[model samples]
Target: MQEKIKAFMDEVRSRNGHEPEFLQAVQEVADTVIPYIADNEIYNGKNILLRMVEPERLISFRVAWVDDDGEIHVNRGYRIQMNSAIGPYKGGLRFHPTVNASILKFLAFEQVFKNSLTTLPMGGGKGGSDFDPKGKSDDEVMRFCHAFMAELFRHIGPFTDIPAGDIGVGAREIGFLFGMYKRIQNEFTGVLTGKGLSWGGSKIRPEATGYGTVYFAQDMLLTKNDDIDGKTVVISGSGNVAQYAAEKTLQLGGKVVTLSDSGGYIYDKKGIDEEKLAFVMDLKNNKRGRISEYVDQYPSAEYHKGKTPWEVPCDIALPCATQNELNGEDATTLIKNGCICVAEGANMPSTLDAVHTFQDAKILFAPGKASNAGGVATSGLEMSQNSLRISWTREEVDERLKGIMKDIHDSCIEHGIEADGYCNYVKGANIAGFVKVADAMLAQGVI
Candidate 1:
């Protein structure tokens, strides 16, 4: 099995050698899914995994726009339509300086399984541009988004491909992109998620990913007769996912101790309650300040320069930052500090070594595909509401999101349990997500 997995990955690496991130994503999936395909007669000889690795469509274009300085700027944009076996392409669009084909491909590949785990009729796709929204004037950001959508609009639509927000892309960016799409296409359709509620956005869309991540972690704890209540939670990232994750943790009686940004992390041992979390939301969303500013507001907290929050003592740790933010050393520190649960709120936030360290410790660890799926699941709900021309209440949407998280948890358990009675969420998520798309691809035949 090891040889087979290595052989498969070697073939993948040959094509994607320059794309470390994409290769890592594929390697993780291949490690678990290949063994399943070997044992399952129906999947053998089909090369289903091989086909899934290759995107059905990859579109790249140039986005040109004027900045506030009246200077013309050009950025590379990409859309990786990974798979449409289960439904039309569905995923998020990121607008950050780090956006590239490799990163987008990794994200799109992970999206395939994440969407499948949601049990929603949405396939995996991802698009983005290497444009930094941070520090840019709203008008400058709007111009960039419009220019990006100007080219992206031709390849996406309500029924074809729908994009939500990720990383540097958020409600403001989504509004700008959607406005351009509507004007150019001459249609007010559900072409994008994360819109304002007055428009086509669904309730609890912003909170879905963070809340769902906590919900998934709570379920994982429940397996061992544990819960989030009274647990000290350490969370990384101060963005939408991390802020709301802190919010949900507080609501569930968990003491959230930390939140971070690119600059550094801030640790408040007294815990980040609703008030502090609100400050964080404003600090990141409105003020657009560094997380180190959090210490200025709350003098009790200490800010660590150029460090992650994993070193803090806690019962739970949620890595809601970027890919490969958590490494083996960080994982070791968390384990040594008595962290029992680590749920990923960001896609591939943990390095491969970090993941192995966590799994080897036999602690509860939920992958982003299973734990952070609420964002996309709620986006699916938004799509449904748009298609039906109806809106669900906040309570209704929240309940549905909870149900979806629970269902994803159950699916992970059904597939991820090993002979030692420990659940391997990574393996479970990969295999469980693989079976659905693989079956759909099998039934549809090769494209």
Candidate 2:
């Protein structure tokens, strides 16, 4: 079994040797899914994994736009239509300088499983550009988005492929992209999630991922007859996922003591309350300021330069930051600090070693595919609403999001239970997700 998995992975490495991020994502799934495939004859003897690794469609194009200074800037854009056997190509579009084939492929690979775990009819895909939105004027950003979407519009549609927001792409960016798509196609469709509510966006879509991450962690605690009512949480990243994760934690009576950006993390021993979190929202969303300014508004907080929040002792940890941000050492530190639960809000936020360490320690750990499916799940919901041409209320959307997270948690337990009764979330997530996509692939008969 080991030899087979290794042989398959060796081929993966040969094809994607230059793509460490994508290779890492593939290896994680291969580690868990191969064993399950070996045990299931239905999935065995099929090169499904091989086909899954290769995307169904990978589109690359050039995006050219004029800056505010009227200077022309060209950037590369891509959309990896990973798989659509289950449904349309559904995923987020990230705009960051680090956006490359490797990272997008990794994200798209992870999205296949993540979207599957959502219990929604959505396949996996991811697209983005190396165009950084930071420090760019609204006009500049709009121009870039327009240029990018001009190319992307040809490939996506409501029932074909749906793209949402990630990282630097937010509601503002979504509006621009959708406007371009609508303008180009001359049609109003739900070709994208995370649209403005005034148009067709779903309620609570912004908070779904973070809220669902915390909800999954809350479910993890429930198995031990514990709760998040008083647990301290350390979260990385202050982006949409981190901000809303903290919001949900506060609502659940959890003390969120830390939120970080790439610059560093801010430790607020006083806990970032709703009011403080609102300040953070304004600071990051409107002001576009660094997290260090958090200390200025609330003197009780201390900003740690060039550090992550993992060093802070907490009962729970949510790595909402980018991939590989939490390493083995960080995992060790969290476990040693008495952390019991770790839910990933970002795609593959923990390294392979960090994940192994958590698994070895028998701690409750939920991978992003399971823990952070809320974003895309809600995107799926938005699609439904758009198809129906009606919208659900906030309460309706929130309840659905909570239910989906609970379902994902239950599914993890169903597949991830070990001999000693410990649930390996990564293993459970990979297998449960693989079963759905693999069966669909099999049914389609090598298409």
Give RMSD (Å) of candidate 1 vs. truth. Answer: 0.7
* Lowest-sum lDDT 10-residue window in model 1: 269-278
lDDT of 2 by residue, 42-62 (tens): 999998998999999999999
Q: Estimate TM-scores for all models.
A: 0.99, 0.99
lDDT of 1 by residue, 273-332 (tens): 889899989989999999998888999999999988888999999999999999999999
Q: Candidate 1: lDDT of 302?
A: 98
Q: Poorest 10 consecutive residues of model 2 by lDDT?
A: 150-159
